[model samples]
Target: MNEDRLQFWSLYATRFAEGFGFITLVTLLPSYINTLDPTGTTILGMTISAGLIVGFYTSGFTLAQTVAIVPLAWAGDRFDKRTVLLAVLAIGIGVYALFPLVDSSASLIAVRALQGVAVTGAGLMTLSLVGEIAAGSTRANHIGKANAASYAASIIGSISAGSLFELFGFGPIFAVIVCLMFVAWLGVFRYLKPDETRIHGFPFSDLALNRRLLTLSSFRFQYAFSVTLVRTWIPIFAGVAAAEGGLAYGGLAVALTVVAEKFTNMCCQPFTGRLSDSYGRAMFVFAGGAAYGFVALLVPFAPTIGAALALPTEIVLVVPSALAGIVLPAWIPLEVIPTQVSMFGEVSPAFLPLVALSGLLGIADSFREPASMALFADEGTDDGGVASSFGIRELVWRPGSVIAPLLGGWLMYEVSMASVFYVGGLFALTGVGTFLVILVWSHGRRALVEW
Candidate 1:
């Protein structure tokens, strides 16, 4: 490969590894909850609830990412991004290998926090490098491709983690993840060129005050809550038991729910990026966010839709019986029901509609992500702190991401599982509304199309 192609692909590999490792952990969370703490445990002599355990465990990852964003982004800009990225990959190898050794919830959270740092460092550096290398005209297209690689890895990771965990337990799955990270580390060390671009002093002070970034942050801050809640809970809702307001589907079925959004997002990003490049980016961002909220509202109603639509209750297959040419064996239903049915063998009416809604979520995000990313890249390049620009973006997202899971967990445990999606959808709608108001007030309504 040529220098540019090699650079992009190497960065892509880093992005892929980051997504793969992260999603694998997310996919196995329910299993961890079941195995590690079926009921809640006490921490520091205070009784912690099951809901709180889930919240802390999930947020631990985000919290570490939140804390690491500034330092990692600064390093990427001030030093060599390639070197920083390699260091993160090395951290990732150690973190994933530690998963099998997690004996308690506290230990798991500690390890997940380390995993968070690795993910954030790798993500910030790779995105910075990709944005710097690509031309302004096609920046979104390149970013879209990078994001597509992440989403593709998400789909693969979610499915494979669930399958491997079900078959061989967490040890083999994490061992495989460790191998993937090691391979990514080797690829970066061998192929990615040293990044000579450097910025002295703190770049965030200047970039954080930029008008464009402020406007984008207005949307991103709220949008983070929406995406975090919706994306994280979809798998939780599918995998957990019915008494806990979940579908209680098998690992594979739960993975499919997670895959639905990612698969569509992966497929649609490149095209959407090119479109955003040609047309106005802000429009796509607003439209996508609004569409996502609307879809999220519908997610809670999936079971109702399935039941109302009267989809198949039990799938039947024909076999050649000894006495007949073709016969349906009673035993066939027994085999299919356990793996396919939800909630004590009454075929889950919600599966198809939930998957469909998840797919819609993906389609909605596809419209927003690339356009939003390109806008950041544009301001970053113009301001001469591309890494810091992306850093601020990640920084802005941290609050919402860190808090949303805690809120979602509380809502799931206290109210209902469906309440999480309701609040998530509301956040998206409100975010889009706020963004539009800010855009028109500051830039005029014409800015919607012209921006």
Candidate 2:
């Protein structure tokens, strides 16, 4: 392979590893909650509720990500991006290796925070490098392909993590992740060249003031809350106990729900990105965000939809005779690994509907993501601060991503599970409204098409 192809693929491999680790945690989160059973804790003379502790599970990660962005982004721009990418990948290996040692909610939170830093740094560097290397005309197309690689990892990681966690618990799962991280690190070391681009001073200072970027941030800032809450909660909703306002499905079932979105997004992104390149990006952003909100609002109605459609409550899968022994030890009675496995523990009318909704969420985000990313790449490339631009993008998302989990947890425990989706959906709808108004007011009505 030529240098360019090798470099791109290496970067994509890094993205894959990052996504794999992130999604593994997400898919296994409900299991962690069940195992750890977080309760109220007294810290500094103040009592924190279990709900808040649950919120901290995710928020801790995003909080670290938020803190890491500025320094990482600046490092990528001011120094060698390839070095930055490699450093993070190394950190990732250690982070995944630590997961098997987590014995309490506090340990999980601390480990997740470290994971946040690694993931954020890897993401900023890879994206910034991709945007810098690709041609302006095909920037979104390339970015789409890169994101598709991540989503593809998410699909595999979620399914494998869920299945392995069910069969063998957490040890094998992190082992796989650590190995993947090592492979990605090797790919980068062997094939990817050092980044030569360097920009002096803070590009964020300039990009922050850019009119077009500000307009895009108007939408992204709010959309962050919507995506973060809905995406994180989909698996949580499927796997948590029914008493927790969930469907109480088994591991494989939960994986399927998470996979649905990743699969659809992976399939659609390249095509949607190409289309966004031809059609106006702004239009795609607006339409996609609106559609996502609409789908999110329907998540709470999954059970009703499934009941009305007369969907099957449980799906029974018969293990093939050849694989039965391999799947589980032969000495362990057939009762445990019975010929037929119940995918859903009990009657779960909401399973299919939730999966379908998650898929729709993927399709909607496919359009919005590539278009939004391409816009940021455009401004960053034009201004010679691609890394910082993406950094700003992350920073804009930080507030919502950091806080939405806490809100979702509170709603799940206090108000209702449905309330999380309601609030998340409203944020998207209102976000688009603000984005459109800003787009038209700042750039004029014709700018949406022309830009």
Candidate 3:
């Protein structure tokens, strides 16, 4: 391979490692909550609720990500992005290795916080490098491919994590992640070239003030809350107890629920990105965000949908003897060949509909993500601060990413679970409305098609 192709693939490997680690944790979160069983606690004589503690499980990670963004993004712009990426990957290896040590909620939060820093650094450097290397016209196409790599990793990670955790528990899962990170580190070290580009002073100030960026931020800011709340809750709704308003699925089943979205998003991004390259990116953003809100609103109605459609309550598969022997020799006895597997343990009528809705959510977001990313790359590349531009993008997402989990937890525990989806859907709808008015007012009607 040529040096450029090598570098691109290496960076895509980095994205894969990052996505694998992140999705593993996401896939296992319900298991963690079940294991930890968090309760009310007194801190400095003030009581904190269990619901808030549950919220902290996710918020702690995102809060750390919020904290790490400015410094990491600035370092990527001001110094060597390649070096920064390698360091982050090193940290990621350590973080994944530490997952097996999580004994309590507090410990998990601490580890997740460190993971946030690693994830932020990896994401910022890889994306900035991709944006900088690709030409403006094809930036979205390249970015779409990069993101597709991440989603592919997400699919594999969620499925493998769920399956492995079911078979061997958490230790082996992290061991696999650690080994993957090491391989990713080797790819970057051997194939990726050093980034010599440097920018002096802060570019965030300039990029933040860019009118186009500001308009995009208006939509992104609210959309962040919508995406974070809905995405994080999907696995939770699948795996948590039925009494908690979930379907109470097994690990593999829950993983499938999460995979539905990742799989569809992975499939659609590259094509949608190319279309956005030909058509208008802003139009894609508006359409995708609106579709996402509509699909999110339908999530809570999965049971009704399933019942009306007469969907099966459970799915059963009988494994062939040869396949069963190859797949489960270590976990199951050879005498148990031709095993019958219950994919969903006492699955609710909502399972199939929920998975379908999740896939629709992915289809919706695929249009929005690459298009929005291309816009940021366009602005940042013009301003000579691609990393800082993406930083501003991350910063715009911070408040929503940090706060939505807490809000979702409160809504999930205090109100109905459906209320969480309701509130999240409203945010997306309102956000698109605000984005449209601003886009038309600031850039005129033709802006959606032309820009």
TM-score of each: 0.93, 0.95, 0.96
C-alpha lDDT of candidate 3 relative to the true structure: 0.92
Best by TM-score: 3
Residue-pair clashes, model 3? 0
Instruction: Give the 10-residue window scoring lowest on summed lDDT in candidate 3.
Output: 336-345
Per-model clash counts, in order, read 0, 0, 0
- Cand. 2 Cα-lDDT: 0.93
lDDT of each: 0.88, 0.93, 0.92
Candidate 1, residue 309: the lDDT equals: 93
Candidate 3 local lDDT, 67-178, one digit each (tens): 9999999999999999999999999999999999999999999999999999999999999999999887788888999999999999999999999998999999999899
Q: After superposition, how far is residue 126 of candidate 3 from its true place, in Å?
A: 0.5
Ranking by TM-score: 3, 2, 1
Give the better candidate number (1 or 3) by TM-score: 3
What tens digits encode model 1's per-residue C-alpha lDDT throughout 64-178?
9999999998998899989999999999999999999998888999999999999999988898888999998888899999999999999999999988888798889888888
> What digit string (tens of lDDT, one per residue) describes model 2 on residues 1-451?
7888888899899889999999999999999999999999999999998888999999999999999999999999999999989999999999999999999999999999999999999999998888888898888898999999999999999999989998899999999999999999999999988989899999999999999999999999999999999998888888888898988888888999999999999999989988988886998899899999999999999999989999888788888766876777768775566677886566577888898899999999999998999999999999988999999999999999999999999999999988999999999999999999999999999877776
